[model samples]
Target: MADPVILVDRPAAHVARLLINRPDKRNAIDHAVRQQMAAALSALAGDPDIRALVLGGVAGVFSAGGDLPSMKGLDEAGARARMAHIHGLCRQIAEASLAIVSAVEGIGAGGAIGLALLGDEIVVGEGTRILFPFLRLGLTPDWGQLLTLPRRVGLPAARRLLIGGGPVDGAEAFRIGLADEVTADGQVMTRAIERASALAQLPRDALLRMNRRLEMPSATLSDELAREADDQARCLTGAEFNEGYEAFLARRTPDFSHL
Candidate 1:
């Protein structure tokens, strides 16, 4: 039998940890992983004993983003549906009463970067890399990044990342406000759990309300989610995406000059 893609454990009385276990694929989020995460997070949200949650990935690597093979042949409608499922998972994280932390060790790229940002506090390993390569793939940002990135890193930095596809290391991530804390190599999960433990001791209702107040203003979550779907659908159906996908599979730089 195959190993479960998502692993749940209660490391402390008030803390739950959700580990993405697909290290063989760099913990890429496929349909099964998405469904499993959604179910696990939903259950955690309703557990009164769980005051905090830590999300991490196996083998020192966080997610590499969406499983490209799973997305290879998707049409516009299919792309939108897939993104919507991911959006639901993000919504679960955002709305959960439990304080959430992302223990980022390795790469958190593309949509996975968005997932990391969903955390109330992101603990990053010193060597970890965070990037958004959506433009390189000829795709728009999805998974509510359009809403969350600016709130974390401000509008100008967000534009540089989303448009220029630049990458940031843990130190740079902290300097730019993209990461809440940076720890020594291999210590991200430990630090994240420590932070979660501290957060768990706070008044739950007050914590939830404070999180809500910190949320990005001027647009509802649903509105930004809808915009993400629409924009991704448009890009997914374009010829440029085809070129980019092919180049990715061939391990070569894509030529987009003609597009």
Candidate 2:
């Protein structure tokens, strides 16, 4: 049998890394990839020991975007269903409790960039190419790009990039807030994993609430204040806060394992 398209590895106690392993197709996302990715993420979501996740692709390539060959015979209904599945996965990433970091290298094009943005941070190699190819391909952007991209780079830049812009390198991506960090080619995964591991050290429960609160683009000031007040109240009464307060008083780091 062939190797699995997605590989799950635990590089740290609280960090789970999922690598797209279909190197022959340059890690193109397809039906198989989508199903496997969803299953893996679902399993990780329930594991209290895991607090962070790293998304990457093997052989130094992020992804070539959606698998074009897989789209050859798809009818309109099929296409719609496929996009729905992808959007569901995007929602999963958006609401994930674990901190997420993307390790991007050779290329992240079209839908792949949107997928990467669902995560909290992205680390790219200096030479990595980030492209928007939706219009050029006679398609509108999918994979939640319409929502996530704007939230990531703001509406002005998102419009510019999605409508007609050409490819941008990793350094340019970092400069434009498309990427969180840019490193040398060979160190992308290492840096991404390191970032995720560090993020895992944070109080994950509070972090999840904070992410959810901030990602709500439609929430008004009044709405956010009400939500924030409730969320903060819960956090204050949680065991994590007690531990954190004790640690602060002792001038030591908080160990929140299973707290």
Against the reference, the lDDT scores of all candidates come to: 0.83, 0.89
* Candidate 1 residue pairs that clash: none
Prediction 1 global C-alpha lDDT: 0.83
The root-mean-square deviation over C-alpha atoms between each candidate and the true structure, in angstroms, is: 17.9, 1.3
Alpha carbon RMSD to native, model 1: 17.9
Query: Candidate 1's residue-wise lDDT over 32-69, tens digit each?
Result: 99899988987877777888899889999888988889
Best candidate, lDDT: 2
Candidate 2: tens digits of C-alpha lDDT, residues 1-259: 9789999999987999999989999899998988899899999999989999999998999998999888888899998898888988888888888899999889998878888989999999999998888898888988888888888788999999988655899888998899999999999999999999899999988888888877774357888778988999999999989999999999999988675
Indicate the residue-level lDDT of 147 in model 1: 84
